[model samples]
Target: MDQRPAISASQAGDGVTLAASGNWTVTEAERLNGEIRQAARLPSGTRRVTIDLSGIDRFDTAGAWLIHRTARNMVNDGLEVVYTGIGPSREILIGEVEKSDRPPAEPRREAPFVTALVNDTGEAVIQSGRDLVQLSSLLGSTVLIMAGFLFRPWRMRLTSITYHLEYMGLRAVPIIALISFLIGGIVEQQGAYQLRYFGAEILSIDLAGILVLRELGVLLTSIMIAGRSGSAITAELGSMKMREEIDALRTLALDPVEVLIVPRLIALVIALPLLTFVANMSALAGAGLTAWIYIDVTPQTFLPYLQNAVALNTFLVGLIKAPFMALVIGMIACLEGMQVKGSAESLGRQTTAAVVKAIFMVIVLDGLFAMFFAAIDY
Candidate 1:
């Protein structure tokens, strides 16, 4: 009784028999693997195969699985396979392996292009509606909280509001002024170049004045805030959410929105209008200087043309849009932050989404305001 693994094949009139003997266990896996491979190569005229396991000295799952795999491969190659003399224990082990050895899965088919497009469009529409509902709910809750503050003014977070104002507004002035100044100078140069053909280069001052006051001042400022302050708000709140500080606030019987969101929103509302005013003046100053250098239109001449070109309503229109844009940016930032999951990747994703959505909404809102003003001939 040799205890080493061995396999031998015999052929007789289109039939083959494979006899497996000795220790068919993990200890003999290396030899058993070679023997199993050798057993698979049968005589050319053989049409049927039988695996005789009666001589096996010991058995285990590793050997059973190898034997089952060889048989499976032979069956797949169109040979009839049979097993004989396998005792109850070995048979059970082989049966388990057979059950676990599943065939390869088929590839998936793709949907038609038109069907996929329709499904994507429908999902976007549904998501937009859901976003609208959630934003409205948040607005309502914020309004309620503010209304409560009317009865208890001391509950308002004035210190937080002041801090955010300085952070979002005061610290932002230098970059905003630089950007606005460059834009105004470019606008003036382009206007002067075009108007010079008609010998009306001085009118570039009028163009810069009216455009900045009526549109560019507030629009550019809002976009800047959306990219800068809005993203910061989302990141801050998202970090709090990831650390479970927001949950801790809840446990302390405090409203996270009231403590965290209201102050930021109030600060934005106050800061944006002031920033818009700064942007308008900076743009006007840049335009005037460019006009003087490019067209020799002195400030003395530029001032009168600017006065005649834009009215009080023109300035008020741009200022009026600021607080609304601020509100939109704040709400979108807070909503995206609150949706952050407990992961750094989620925080970064939500922060990017906040800036994108806020800028888009700000532009859309500006368009609506423009349409309203045109309709009323304001």
Candidate 2:
């Protein structure tokens, strides 16, 4: 026999009485649903409803929810609703469903364009201030740690520093050299091409020499390191953080700032200046080669023109910026790493943020250095 649920309703005066029978489990849900709809279509003049469940043979949470929903809907339609024959257990279930039921959240209305723009701008300004404060805190911590290391050099993790140097510096040299070389070649070729219009192709050597020494070489090196090494630093530290290794270090009375971050920071501070010097050499070599091959300018003539074009301050300006940029990149990477939450998604997010923020800060530091040097006429 098909165990379908049934509903019978009777109308008297201005009241409707509904009797529910048979199984009201999910198997009979379709039938119960149809019966409920039919019972709801009472006489238009009806103002009260009473639902009786005494004849119901079976009931579940689903059936109870449906009953509760029907009663609530009747109340919403301006009818006085009454439910009867619900046992203690079924009544508790129904009560739970009623308590848990909530209307869907309303969609938010968007503000006007001008209002939204102003709001967003204010939020951005506030966020930038918070970021500046965090960065400054990290900087102060790093400086204090480094100063302490000077007194207790043995506390510095030499092995970790060497490993990071190999990971971040040695592995990075080829790409840095290749990119800087190509950039240098392109700049020289363009300079030669433009100079040819004025019959001054020899001036290409001077242009390439001055540009690479004062700006392009170290700048490109710092940007590359920020993207490459900074992301790796964040991923490593973030993974450790996510796995609670950083917390473990703290529990063991080991300072993570000194044990982990300081090594990487020292490696970057030492490595970046060396890498920048190598980049400068590679760039000059590429420029010289390009001038010889493309513009028929020989090494001998190029050397004389380069020496005459760039002063000692030009080389020092780029080299001096390398350590500061390195410090910024390393600090941002470590700061973001320490911010990672306990999830792979958080680790990935922090890693990406580290790279992006490090690169941005590196560029910003370069600009500030440029302005300061210009102000001092260095």
Candidate 3:
């Protein structure tokens, strides 16, 4: 037999004393139980027990489970089990409850690089062709929509043209100017290096003029308008789609496609060429400034050289590309916007897609123009 603590019963106050401090074992379970049972036998009016596991260092789960059970039993017997200087040394009774509650997640992996590249390229081409067909159809529909205008000549289409032009054209000029100037400076520098090798630096002016006129002038304008105006159009139309406002118009016997999309497409096709002309002029001025600074070539000398940089075909080439790019931007915006699913997040994603797709198409168009120009023996 081993020593068990005795609870001193009293009329006024009664308490139990623990003999040692740290580290007890389940082998000592029966000994602890006898002490606790004795503490419970104290008078109800004077019931309180203090446990001190401050000694006997080193314990295991067996000891902790035993303590828990004793504490429960003491509390049930109207004895207060004050755990003093007691750290939970081996508390492991609630094992599977905690384990089952936390469901483990699967780790994620990226797709293989080659397969990913193939999938992405295929998707982009298919999506581009789809957008092109949609643009052509929208163009035909917009022209056909003018048939409604013959009846009500001052209709919504007319208003939309004015509104979209004001929005996309006038407001977009300053930034377009800045971007063109920077592009001209960069192009002049690139051309200067090559032209300098032959002491033909003055030809950099002609080179800048040709690039700005034939490529960056129209290309930069289209890219800027796509990100700015095209994104806005997509977001606006996507919002309307989300709110079912487009459908509500259909319920009123109105064609949402003609009223909304047609004017925007027409406005873009009409506006981009004028915007490109402005960009071309601005870039040429910037290139001339660069030439003046580096090569000591004055605009009077530069302007005459620039005048013969290309034939009439170069001037007309940008105009042709402009309408196509504008049409691409507008149709892409409207199509993606209309395709937006629920939630504002989808609208934002579609707007981004529209802008990116439009810019990519503008670049591709420029490459085609380069090929076409080269083939023409220019």
**Where is model 3 more than 4 Å wrong at Cα?**
1-140, 146-156
Candidate 2 residue-wise lDDT, 2-75, digit = tens: 44688889988999999888888887777777778878888989999989988888899879877888898889
Per-residue CA lDDT of model 1 for 1-378, tens digit only, reads 688888889887888999999888898898779878987898787779999999998999888988898889889888999999998889999999988888778887888999999999999999889889989999999999999999999999999999999999999999889999989999999999999899988778878988999899999999999999999999999999999999999999999999999999999999999999999999998999998899888889888889998899999999999999999999999999999999999999999999999999999999999999999999
lDDT of 3 at 257: 80
Instruction: Give the lDDT of residue 193 in candidate 2.
Output: 95
Cα displacement (Å) at residue 102, model 3: 13
The candidate scoring highest on lDDT is 1
What are the candidates' C-alpha RMSDs? 5.9, 3.8, 13.1
Candidate number of the best TM-score: 2
> TM per model?
0.76, 0.82, 0.66
Give the alpha carbon lDDT tens digit for every residue of 83-156 in model 3. Answer: 56565433233232224435477776778999899999999899878877876777677778767777877675
TM-score for candidate 1: 0.76
When sorted by TM-score, best at the front, the candidate numbers are 2, 1, 3
lDDT of 3 at 351: 93
